[model samples]
Target chain A: MKDSSVAQRTVFFISDRTGITAETLGLSLISQFEGIPFIHVTLPFVDSAEKARETTQRINQAYQQDGAQPLVFATIVDPEIRSLLEKCDGFYIDFFKTFIPGLENELKMASANVMGRIHGVGDSNVYNTRIEAVNYALNYDDGARTNGYDTADVILVGVSRCGKTPTSLYLAMQFGIRAANYPITEEDLHSTQLPKALRPYQHKLFGLTIDPKRLHAIRSSRRPNSQYAQLAQCENEVKTVEAMFHQENIPYLSSTNLSIEELATKLMVISGIERRLR
Target chain B: MKDSSVAQRTVFFISDRTGITAETLGLSLISQFEGIPFIHVTLPFVDSAEKARETTQRINQAYQQDGAQPLVFATIVDPEIRSLLEKCDGFYIDFFKTFIPGLENELKMASANVMGRIHGVGDSNVYNTRIEAVNYALNYDDGARTNGYDTADVILVGVSRCGKTPTSLYLAMQFGIRAANYPITEEDLHSTQLPKALRPYQHKLFGLTIDPKRLHAIRSSRRPNSQYAQLAQCENEVKTVEAMFHQENIPYLSSTNLSIEELATKLMVISGIERRLR
Candidate 1:
């Protein structure tokens, strides 16, 4: 199964704090080169000079093993450590220093150059807001509590296994949006109308639907051989719920092919929901 | 209450897809410039020439209002659209094009130049893995069910409201790790040994502890004027659980001043848990 024609490379994500920002940006950059397979190593909390030197040796060892210079994507804030990493036997891309100058010149002020500020616990209020949103999502998940619908920033509605719970949690955790999801049961699907609990929050509603075949597979994994997992049952539920969404004028999307990030972002845009935290 | 010494600027995150990568990298880049207050606007799903032109006029209008060129962070992959954005009235930072050439030269292949590939549903197996992880986290949350702990990658043990749930969810959602959390009840804390259920899985345990004062505040917010929220009660419980962690020789970290991302990353590193997906 191996493709010998394809190339292989070693990549590192280096940072002083959590290497999330570095990894995310680096992954996005390398995703463009589809023909090469990258083996990733993340070096987080590389703050001290000794750690930087050790990381340089590791990169060198990787180069020796692979017969190619490893690619290093770094977000180190300390100038001394940053320079040491730059001297390593690899192709180094400095994510921080490369863009700081343009921002400094445009803003007419110097950067604080503080380490661990990006992913650290900055602005206690924002941190608390995010935690609160996560708690809200859990408390209001899957129509467990309809009394709290008024406080929700957006309410997601769909049939069972239509990808509502994960999307709600993603909205809350990533953006501090208080999202609640309500599953459209078979009874509600047959009624051809919105559920009574959700009728009052029509303005805050967004719908999600999935292909019947995908729904069948997802449900079969959860409850194999049950009536709920039958393909005909899934088809009926999806068809009825989609009809309800269309008749009620609710904006919706297919969750069949979209990732949670794409679904959350698209839902926020379509519903005009403002994120409470950045 | 606005500080007159702080400068004001408008920033734009423009992308053909979800714009999450552009926004995250742009935010990290701007967080360094602490003296400026930025107003952020994200234009996602701009996949056509008309939308690009409209975005240009919008950026121009922002410049006219602020009397300064806005900072635009873009990840548009189309050469024509990328060039169009370059002509906008802003300090444009092309996140994709700026780094593509170096990657192309190193890989010795033409860049795929694909739009929406980074955050899109590239592989069904990875997507399903993340969804399955999310479901596992929810199912095993708060010691809801311990029968499935044998299948978990990591079991987070902590006191009530000690930030076990959010960290577990983040580990699952962000990195596709099947994380399960157990809240150490008062009965378990009074005992001098590990819980009966956790004895067999000592190697999979990771402890989370928080400062008593902070825990008291968080608990009070949930149930005010209760014995559980008293400072003395929090102090005793924290001391006991921390002693238990020490006696058991379990790896642990403080969640007091750490964000979810930071906590999850540190835990993953200390526990040596490999991420299932990149």
Candidate 2:
């Protein structure tokens, strides 16, 4: 492998819970390396020593078959299980062991050494908050249930198919914020004033706009060849919505090249909405 | 500072884009240290030197006030701006710098050194897939558009408030999978048979059940004092759903103490649904 005999390597993300932490940090690190192709295998819920041994067997098999030591990234909290994984025919990168010692040394404290906590439902309160936020987002989606705008943490206003719904849902699910989204119709854009229903919650209002070409592509997929999906219509709608945002002095972001996660967190910072979870 | 004079440390999550990566890795490492309270601050979209300078001043101010080197976790990829930030009076954890050089030496290729592309909209296809999946989940939520069941990657069947809606949405939003959910009514539960509409899609079926007490609490919030919120009703529904799942050989999981992320990914593994993104 050092002589470049193999271009691809097997990478295992092992965790006692969901393996999300292992996969996340492993992927971020792997993305830094450009030429080496990695085949990622995420093995979750490996909580028992038996499960760890089985996973170790798989890792050894990968090493044998590939004729190179595999890269294993693990967050197993149990020392015995970590030792078992360490004995495998792989270059082990223990996320917990690597960072926990440094932190313990820094703070002069011991870690909890528990499993299934990070990104897991070990905390009932956090789980309930996420579920409640999801429900809230679903109920208030697309300006469907506008009665609870007073309770909303933020209100996203945009033209049809301008990424309001997904951004609202993402903010709710990830941040535990109740986000209500209202569609900015042509009438509202023409009126040059905030919607009658949203006027009371202007402080919580944020706006989204998108590139006309991309919006046209998205709208065309939904309603093919309709006047609504025409390029001119998309262009007109985007310009009008952005102009309305400017006139109203409402902070806005363009969704042309943005993901829902990006839009959600950015708008939270812009509108000063507090995220419920750390 | 080494004598541990400070009770709390100021931590800044700075990035050229959304700052999600910095926050995520920083928080994960921070959690391992049990007792030290951290004042978490996020500064996003610091793409210019001016913004970097402003952030540096803020960091210096925190250093002066706290009388300790502030912990600055940065994901900035711009060399010039990063050098400017390195001049600040803080302990900087440069994510890009710490890992990219090793990668370049390993792969014998220089990094792109670009900003804000990892979690941003650098890949339009990925962004569109997420949006498309979210829209599908919303449209197919709660069996509202059950006719498209044939197109679903997985169909979740459960009683009311057993976490079908949130799990379906989470799977779609995170994995870009088309998920359709159906609610099992009392009639179907009593009859001890799968819903007629879901019979043909049995191979794609997955089930979710929850603890009666938790279900009761959840239902009570939505429909207080109703028969639906009664503990007996919740218990009966759970028993019926589990029996049906067992009889039909449909793989199932408990949502009682699981987060939506866990439920979504685990069920995807059970149902063999492929994730759209790497």
Candidate 3:
């Protein structure tokens, strides 16, 4: 019989991906409702209808016991499961329903877009381990005399300042891939060959090539407008790097307009690393 | 179909908090299953039964569509809501159900151990913030001339090597609180008074008093068996520090037998910071 207006609401986030992504995203969304006091619960990685049903019953009992209704925010990817949740006695917000329509519309607009099963590379652990290995390789310094090319999980050969460090670190931190990068110096480029130690790990090698303009912009951030950061020189260097990758048949991804996530995802998808995790 | 061995399971973590706690704990549990390839999803912050139903339906749909059954691992505090989740289409594991029995048994064993619901601590954020604040205060190092005593979130005025730095850093890193510590030098001991700057923030302050033997062991890790790390001296220092805290009416927790997490959790609960987040 207290003021009805002051009643506190409870909220839950249900997802299939350890609920970390849902929780992270939900935290931002909840921040929008600053003043309302709400209780939050997270149910993560629920992968079955039986578990879902049990969770729903529990929610129903909580409502009956507390004499208050609660709200649920869910990101369930399966459709039949969504119907099971619909029978519950409380209010619910489904994220997939909200997002799917938009995704479908985008797919329609791009008629030629590829539709294929997204092969997951392995569990988070395998992906994380590989990323870590790559990072360890890239950060190896050998007293400025020799390239620390031996330690790379995947030694990426490219021209100077071609989106190596950040990409490597992102892969390592997010996915745990050990990435190493070695710049194809002028001598190596003149010979048109990868460094000697890289030969043994050629099967694990990848390359990144970017437009000189993009490279110049990226380089300019660290050292503004220097000769080393010149656009024309960058373009020339990129052309040489591309030719080398093409000649050596070292697969490369363009860094021109790709986000780090997109680049990593694409590389992971194409590199046959996705299926090797199991 | 291939031999009907156990199909891979999907695990769910449901929580009233951000699900971070459940996820962290669940991850540790799942890590025990070395060869199993299971999917993990999180449904965070489910506040009500209606929402739980919607989420349950989604789980059913996933079962129907993907043919992947799920297992739920949850930490739902509200009983009625727990029943709702139990009805879902999966095997379920609830942490509260698992822990409550033990807790009840403990209560029955020790009636004197009962502590009343101190105050309504809102959530974990306030607890974390206070811990961080205390840590930041302790770690603030000013130039050799003057002490950085004014900047502490909670100036822990305790004798030398009295479990200050480790506790402070743990609070700050885990909770993002700005913690600072000030040593109770011999001059302060002679005067037998808390620092002047700590007066205004007394409510926010916390004290950690440990047994002298425990304090000596902790100190010996840094400088082995030195006079500064002596058990007798440590015992005397602890005695003096406890007397000062008691004289000033400042509440404190013992660090003698508590793990860092347990210590921090107790401090958060006792200091009334947990209620602020809710």
Candidate 4:
């Protein structure tokens, strides 16, 4: 038999959303336990009872073979399957346990304070609506683009080569944000004002600016040493565009060192965009 | 001035990857502390001293205007920029702060253990290599198949219509795993073995299966009522494929209810793939 003291504990993440959310959350939790040797297993989309049984059997086998109880970190939404997992012989950390309590508390608190305009809106419906809205925003543009800027949850503005595309795409894919980005040209910078239509929705405007050197480097990779990829031009354009944002009082973030996830999340938080999923 | 308790706190996510990673981590952390009124701002790609100074200025302004200290959660890579953020009058939580001690401890432990394979691999080099590998894996296929399976960190096996594409992509983008997927056809299922070459790398093999009904539903979305999308056929195929996996003793995860994120994270954990980034 393997030494229980040193034998790595097996942890499983069973979920419906491909287990990425659970896995990411689990990894963060595992990081807190510094010296623990744990083997993590992710069993995603195990919706049916049969699959649950199979997973349980595998967990039992792993424990029996190793003489150590494995930890199962799960985000199972279905009631029946979650019950099935509960019967398994292992330590389980369920995200639903945490989510339900928090959600219930929020609902209770909100219901008590019936002063808000949308006070009577049920929490479940609100959450569901937000999720649907996010999904709609994400898949809003298939190809054809009419000037329907009002539909965007957040509008990203930046100069050329300011890391707008990736940031927009990341927000869409990760958080289901319908993030629409428009590059501020030299003309717009010189004009010293945002688009006339954007004036009313300035609250939704978020700007992205990058260092000219970095922009030049990124652009040079795509079009080496071209006029568009010149360091001087990039620097000048970035400065002008940033000045325009400052002059117009448009809040902005620099894209020189931040990751796409950070930028999107920050925008969501700042813009009061509630996340659809935890 | 706004009521101290009612005023929204400013939260910042600063990172090199447009703050995407920091934002994801921060969201998870914030989720743990529900009901905290905080406004999040992302300073992505803030790799320079000038940009950091600008970020500091924003934080200072937010504090002075709001009458509450801003909470900064940063994932900066540059030491100089990180130091600059540290001096900012806000509650700072750096990703590197959580990772560095653990990494140092890991390095010391590895170095002490003369037989450890990672004894000489510096943490920075490992991180850079993993980032490069992840990027390489993400763009592995320009939607075109090549003989790139040889370099894959993990090869996913499943029947057609089972979630292989999204899971593979998530693995590549999130953990930087070069994930290549191959569909197991009836011929292979009947043969009761993985691809002959894959047998040698069984340790890196991951299998994704789904409920027959769900598989039918998914396939029907693509091809309605056809034999390929028939429930009976799907049931038979799933049974045959799962039995084949069981017979071959290849561990697998069901993809019926799990999300893409959960599946990728579970695979990373179960397959013993080391995470390069926190």
lDDT of 4 by residue, A104-132 (tens): 35323322211111111224334334334
In terms of docking quality, model 4 is incorrect
lDDT of 2 by residue, B1-278 (tens): 33565456788999887887788667766765666768889888898999999999999998777766678888888899999998988777777776667556654668777665566675678877877777888888887977988778888898899999888888877778888888888888867778888889999999999998999998998899999899999999999889999999999999987877788878866777788866
iRMSD for each candidate structure, in the order shown: 0.9, 2.3, 19.7, 11.4
What DockQ does every candidate get?
Answer: 0.84, 0.50, 0.02, 0.07
What is the TM-score of each predicted model, taking all chains together? Answer: 0.98, 0.91, 0.38, 0.47
* TM-score winner: 1
Which lDDT tens digits does candidate 4 get at residues B105-221? Answer: 532332121111111123434434444554444444222343556677887778886867656655654565777776776666667666665676676678889999878876796
lDDT string, candidate 1, A5-74, tens digits: 7646899999998998889889988888876779999989999999999999999998887777889999
lDDT of 2 by residue, A1-278 (tens): 34565457798999887777777667666665555668888888888889889999999998777766687878888899899889998878786776677656655678778766557676678777877887888888888987998888888899999989888888878788988889998777677688898888888899999999989999998899999999999998888888878988999999887777678878877778888866
Top-down lDDT ranking: 1, 2, 4, 3
Count clashing residue pairs in model 1.
Answer: 0
Instruction: Provide fnat values for all models in the order shown.
Output: 0.86, 0.45, 0.00, 0.07
For candidate 2 chain B, the 10 contiguous residues with the lowest summed lDDT are B1-10
Clashing residue pairs in candidate 1 (N, C-alpha, C atoms within 3 angstroms) = none
Task: List candidate 1 segments past 4 Å from native.
Answer: A1-3, B1-6
What's the lDDT for candidate 3? 0.56
Question: Model 2 segments beyond 4 Å from truth?
Answer: A1-6, A35-37, A60-71, A88-91, B1-6, B56-71, B83-92
The TM-scores that each candidate's chain B achieves against the reference are: 0.97, 0.92, 0.49, 0.58
Error of 1 at A166 (Å): 0.8
